[model samples]
Target: MNFERAIIIREKTRLEQLIERFNSKAQAKFYIERSGGDFNFYEIENEKFYESLNEVQKSISKHLKLKIIYRSFLPTYIFTENDLIVVLGQDGLVANTAKYVNGFPILGVNPDTERYDGILLKHTPSDMNNLIKEVVKGVFETKKVTMAKAELNDGQTLLAFNDFYIGADSHISSRYEIEFKGKKEKQSSSGIIVSTGAGSTGWLSSIFNMSHNIYGFNTIGENEHQSQINWEDEKLIFVVREPFLSKVTQTDIGFGVITKRQTLKIESNMPRKGIIFSDGIESDFLNFNSGSKVEIGIAEEKANLII
Candidate 1:
């Protein structure tokens, strides 16, 4: 499909440069501001930032076919079919980025390059116009990123772009009775992390004390795999880091797999108090006493990123 319309998502600092860049190239129809309400720090206050973006939107609209839209807080609108979505924010905008632009190939423009991790975004604002041109012209490659889907026993379903963690919220260690396919096993560790290939370099790598290979976890050499479990049953592979212990020391940490299973269930000892999140956003709270079960596996659909 030909993407005629482009959605520009940007913060206040990069507004002028982004406008100039967009105007010089593609004809953007919608200007979406990276409002600071969803962010944790460095927020541009409601009065100042909105007013600034509003004026800039008007100025850009005068020259090109652009309509400036703003939400007093974070926006909840999903992208229209075949719309090109761009995100401009630091780490705090990760969840929102994943939520709004799931199926679409999202291009992230890092406004704050020094502080940002640049996990989702591959480039900065200065290089965005060329990237967008490449994307619209079908000259760029895309990576298929897998996502995790979780279903609680109460019939609640959630999705994670990174990993799903099950463990104690309190200082006390929590035990989990885990079942893979039909076989059952017990884990007495502080928690268990079910991570996606994209998340392997983040939380999973940290827990395992390994370096992240951005291409994917499959590229890791066999020698490295000996220390970690890199086997794949299908699209989903299970890796357990420092399992069966409340506290782990480098000398005692070991990794294993829960076997190749299409469906896996985890019953937490402290069910009601357990937490389930996707890419750091909490989706639902586990109600253990009422027989809560968190099922983890590959999502039916995958995420596509514009690289």
Candidate 2:
């Protein structure tokens, strides 16, 4: 594909957010210091982020037209196949941007090497010039990442690069009727998490860790082992969080694998406050209340990350 421009996606720094809330840099600093926080850290972080962003702009602009957009504007941004996505921030920013890209090639750049793990950021600012050239020439390589989808009966839908959380918005139990492989059960639990292969080591692995320690055994044997689901895997894993067992609710159908052949179906039993959020972004969610039903499955679209 011939690329015409690069769209840089970014998020506001912590200091910037503080300034917005307190109305000024001085006020933000005073509020943080008064609370016994290190105000200097926020300033330094903001400085480094912009410094890296400047480097990225200088390099990529040499090959294509450049435009910068904040994360808040992603939902309404008009993206085309001719645009290359350049995400510069923490790794979560990459996940946050993937669903909106519609399979466009995304180059993840890690701005703060000291602060972020950069699990999805494979390139640094120095690599931008060469990488942009390759992308424009259609010679760049991309790692295909699978995603999960939640489609509501009302025609609304949500996508997740890592995982999807279906449950209540608060700490209260989520009541839902779940069906898989033709078996059905009513469940009352913390919620349900449907994770893609790229997210296996994230929130999903933590659950396995807690279970293995509590049970004193692993899936294979007494020796511990962490399961790995590849980024390209077509399957999904769903685990119920703290399912409650009683006369009306059961915990038997708490865990399973979801595939193209077998999709997971759910119906909300809660009167209100039920939600379905993706990639840990609560603001971007679908209402899942009573009389609402959803189908969970592997998404037809995948995140194409430029590796």
Candidate 3:
């Protein structure tokens, strides 16, 4: 067993964040309970998460060099080729880490299953040790998850594990020219959602559900929505959110599927406030104001998840 290192990625607990913002846990509890929230549940959830992370850390350190990293520091932290990543948080944390990493095999752990769905997290602290042993012995299996990519004309690029949002920063409509499968149209919409196969069951599912309710579009059945996606599928899906019809702007090209051979392109028409962000992280984004053109498609790189 010759693994170089293992990097454990964890997000700050709500309790820790409360202390950071309000200067103490007592103040945070007072504020939450006063506002009719469950402050007791918060404390219990935080304690379970910390204990799970601690146990996982101790087990990994016995076999390989262990490094603990916070989710906030992922962008600046350098990853090595031999590093095995173990994410201890929600499903979104795994998705967030997938974009920044190259091909490191990741083990997703749900520290507190009560607070999370753990759809992407297939392991618990009790089982993490055995998985690490298998990984180090080169006997673990992995699934390759497809990712979405957005590239601007000027060469800046962003990758998304779940989906990408192309629109304004605020509630204002986003104005852009949409081109897909050779047909193009000018549109003013709430935004555009570009999703990978792995993300089809998430944000993309909500958009389709809305369409079904509004237009009686039941082409996608309740069970089939998730059936359409495979983690390793090399394709992409996009839907325009609430496109408005104008005399000049059209709504014919509001939704479509993108593939390796096919792509979706958008040219920004808003003078200001236009932005393109991925994986729900709005703080880190690319300007998509007037004159900016972006191409959305399947990313060349894929995320590997240890099973």
**Among all candidates shown, the one with the greatest lDDT:** 2
Whole-model Cα lDDT of every candidate shown, in order: 0.55, 0.93, 0.88
Give the range where candidate 2 is weakest over 10 consecutive residues by summed lDDT. 218-227
By summed lDDT, which 10 consecutive residues of candidate 1 come out lowest? 24-33
- Candidate 3's TM-score reads 0.95
Q: lDDT by residue for model 2 over 154-240, one digit each (tens)?
A: 999999998999999999999999999999999999999999988888988888887888776734474344555899999999999
Residue pairs in collision within model 2: none
All models, RMSD in angstroms = 10.5, 1.4, 1.9
Better of 2 and 3 by lDDT: 2
* Cα distance off (Å), candidate 2, residue 69: 0.6
Quote model 2's TM-score.
0.97
Can you tell me which runs of candidate 1 are displaced by over 4 Å? 8-75, 91-96, 137-139, 210-261, 283-290
Q: Tell me, by TM-score, which candidate is best.
A: 2
lDDT of 3 by residue, 1-307 (tens): 2568999999898888888998988999999999999998878988899899889998898778999999989888888778889999999999999988887788899898777899899999999777778888888888999998899999999999999999888999899999998899999999999888878888888877676677564666666444257878888888889899999788999778889999899999999999998888886689999999999988898899988
lDDT tens readout by residue for model 1, 1-307: 4565656565444443444656831222133324322322223332343443454334333323432232213245656656666555554354345544656776655555566678777766556545655666767776666677778878877666666766666555556677765667666665667776666666776764453444356777656643222212234444554455435322132233332356668776664566665566553334443256787877765666677
